[model samples]
Target: MTLTRRTLLLGLGAVTLSACADTAPVSSLATTGLPADLRPTPNAAYDAWVASFRSRAEGQGISQSTLNAAFRGTGYLPGVVRRDRNQTEFTRTLEDYLAITASDERISKGRAAFDRHRSTLNAVEARYGVPANIVTAIWGLESFYGERRGDVPVISATSTLAFDGRRGAFFERQLVEALRILQSGDVTPANMTGSWAGAMGHTQFIPTSYQTFAVDFTGDGRRDIWSDDPSDSLASTAAYLSRNGWQSGQSWGREAEDGALQPQPGGPRFAVTRNFRVIKTYNNSDSYAIGVGHLADRIAGGGPLRGSFPPDQFGLTKDDRIELQRRLTARGFDTGGADGVIGNNTRAAITAYQTNEGLAATGDPSPELLRRLGG
Candidate 1:
């Protein structure tokens, strides 16, 4: 699991409802056919929760009607809370995760989207001094260029998480901010649907993120991140990077041919401007940062594999290495388990095979070795 924003939201919805219903009294609202564990609580607990949240919203200048309109009848969403709890364990290895998410399909679609919205993206770039490709890359990665911006109600999702008490304080603050957004007339309840964790719009912004960085690029009297128009979303992302110290004209790191480059003794060899660190704030993973950076580079017309990777000790392409592992296993060599990644087990197996064949026991799988093993 890559633990994208969608997964996080769904998990939050599940856990919140489960916790809320478990703590309710016997005479609480009956949840007969619901997922056994998740049920709505008695109106009293819910009402109390709403009242407390309402007071905070009111303190922030939100009116009573806004609170009522947003929270009335909004039950705890089990799926969203479950996602929030499970985010840590769901991430895949960085290479595999990035390969799937930033596949050629996504890249092709992203290019088309960029072309379609070039004027707005360019205008945003010019105004904010952030590159258009980086903005489009974030949009593509966050919500597949806005094609899948989620369907959960933002207020309901945030409120459920807050009441669930897992990360209660954090969610509570978001809930208050969400209500303030509604009160500010920026977006209505119906239009504020998003990930179950309460990240809304094309770029999946939490309510506070919207308050801090959203822009009304089209001057439509509303900062409409949910609209089909990409202007506001692109501008908002640019503003985020700019405020966080985006460099005016610098490259995010580039991919180098294997062994053609090496990291400096103390740091990464690739050049990462200040804006690159800003991207890391969105998701704190170097692989994620690099994938986004490289994808952005490609979208800007850079060629693939600028240099050749050093030959694997197996003397094979990555795909060929996997095939070697499979063939060695079929020959009863037990090259550990077939995982494509070269490891010590596979090297030992190759050494054993070389010894059996009266060849040099270099432990490196060359073409001659593959031929001898009937690969």
Candidate 2:
């Protein structure tokens, strides 16, 4: 989910269909020279749509002052429309998914973050039944532990998507909820930021989700998930799991000697429990749940999986892929740290090396390519 925001829907057991193939950061106009499409642009149709939406909002209990304040500097963002229209679903293998979600970097960072916020996480776990590591893993997955909480303005994003009419009804509801949040004064219009699709805060809660699950763990009056301190967001996640039936003192799942729950054909098998299903309420993907479970295990000083995946579609084993990456990097092409997962960076590096060797640049690894790279 690196390219796109994690699909953290509020629906407990309902499936979320939206997917994005790529999701680069949308720069803030205040912080950087905004891209033309990302910046707010004038649109007569959008203004007219907002004019119509105002009445419906007021009908739904949005005060006039709240509406006026919410949409003050908000307008159509063409980038939001582009993102909504361009989403395409692509599934990564469970092995690759784990590699990205629970990579060495993420594991190290999760441990550090856990240590730094041990007291807060423990308190949150004590209050809610969800364990601290599970909460920490969700934070790591949602926004890279808050490092990439996005910079898009919530009002502008949801409003633009609502007016676009692809999934207008859903986003319109989100826009209304965002306005209600503004009215509650948890955050201000200027400070209300999120992803292009309007997922917000440290845990990437959509507006409705935030309204339902966000908490004020700091004991302030507001459920402030947008603050630098991650207490509220973390507690909110724990609360969501606890409410959704997270069984205290149970494993989310585990890598078993053998089981029927292998996500990939020749990958490591898992024997999951009821708590694993509870983790799915957050993102609703087996790989995501497993990633969180496994990462939580790792953050608690557990080792990697005991079982192994056979090989990738390219007929390359994890060791072979890692060797290929090392060979490529040795020859002046960087594969972004020899992770066995073949991501965009590895593919780009392969393409560059193939081009240099005057071979067809399919960017797909093969035994021949590995041999050429001195594997």
Candidate 3:
């Protein structure tokens, strides 16, 4: 259940295999090695999947009409599983990931979204005791303020994942909950598109999360987190955090001033509160948690990073820095075998390179030094 790279890959593989299974004819089921680009259309695949779900949902107390209405014509979305599979590659570096998701463009857009939905956000804040900016920042980070709410069919994605048998039981529960969402009239399946992993809405609630925390802030008798009105989604996120122990007054963490402190030796210094650790439970990466926490702070009007980051040692790009470690190891420089992470061995390699070249020995990788290494 830990959200590691291996788990992510397993989830994606499930999605790729299962999304259109119900729609595919029994005759075609025997066909092996289908092209990656092949997919079931909304018309052909949607009803069959819905029919199978409807029977089970009705047995579980979901109304027949509700299931019928919700699941009509939903399709497997293009590029959703592919995108999920490639998420790590896209955000390979913390700096690059932050530059995109926490960029001026996203921040400015988030502020505008905040202003536009101030009333709802404020109401949720008042009710939940969670700040509006934190809620909005989660919204921005999860789905770009609902502008990119994903196009993958939640039922299809979850069902596919569940049947794939990798993490079958976990995803099976999520699949059931997704059907329940439809039966409850919260959202139509066609409109229930989300990440390939089945996380949905502005705040990216998976089906189990939706069952636990989704709210009905609009008072329409439905926990409509997927709609254009962000009230429910925002409220749901606040509820989630509150239930998981989000502190009202504490900060997540702050950037350390010291560049000499490597994550390998001392790890990134973080003055983390209990709530900050709770945020990491959402996605178990320190860099991801830091990015969300920092972005949340910026959205709440905090200033830029207060520390100086030492330039990468060796004349190396981020990728080059990692590659240099690999090349150095090949040349018996013992740069600690490339891990795409800079550490003591890589630092020592840079120091040795500097010593040999009669350059200032800072033990950091710089672009100039990388060129000398033919990087």
On lDDT, the leading prediction is: 2
Model 1, 261-329: lDDT tens digits are 232222223555566676776665566676677677667776544433344444565567667888888
Worst 10 residues of 3 by lDDT: 10-19
Ranking by lDDT: 2, 1, 3
Each prediction's Cα lDDT score? Answer: 0.67, 0.81, 0.63
Scored by TM-score, the top model is: 2
Stretches of candidate 3 off by over 4 Å are 1-38, 41-59, 62-93, 256-268, 313-375
List TM-scores for all candidates, in order.
0.71, 0.91, 0.67
Which model is ahead, 1 or 3, in terms of TM-score? Answer: 1
Across residues 113-140, which tens digit of lDDT does each residue of candidate 2 receive?
9999999999999999788999999999
> What alpha-carbon RMSD in Å does predicted model 3 have with respect to the real structure?
9.4
Clashes of each: 20, 0, 12
The superposed Cα distance between candidate 1 and the true structure at residue 233, in angstroms, equals 0.7
TM-score ranking from best candidate downward: 2, 1, 3
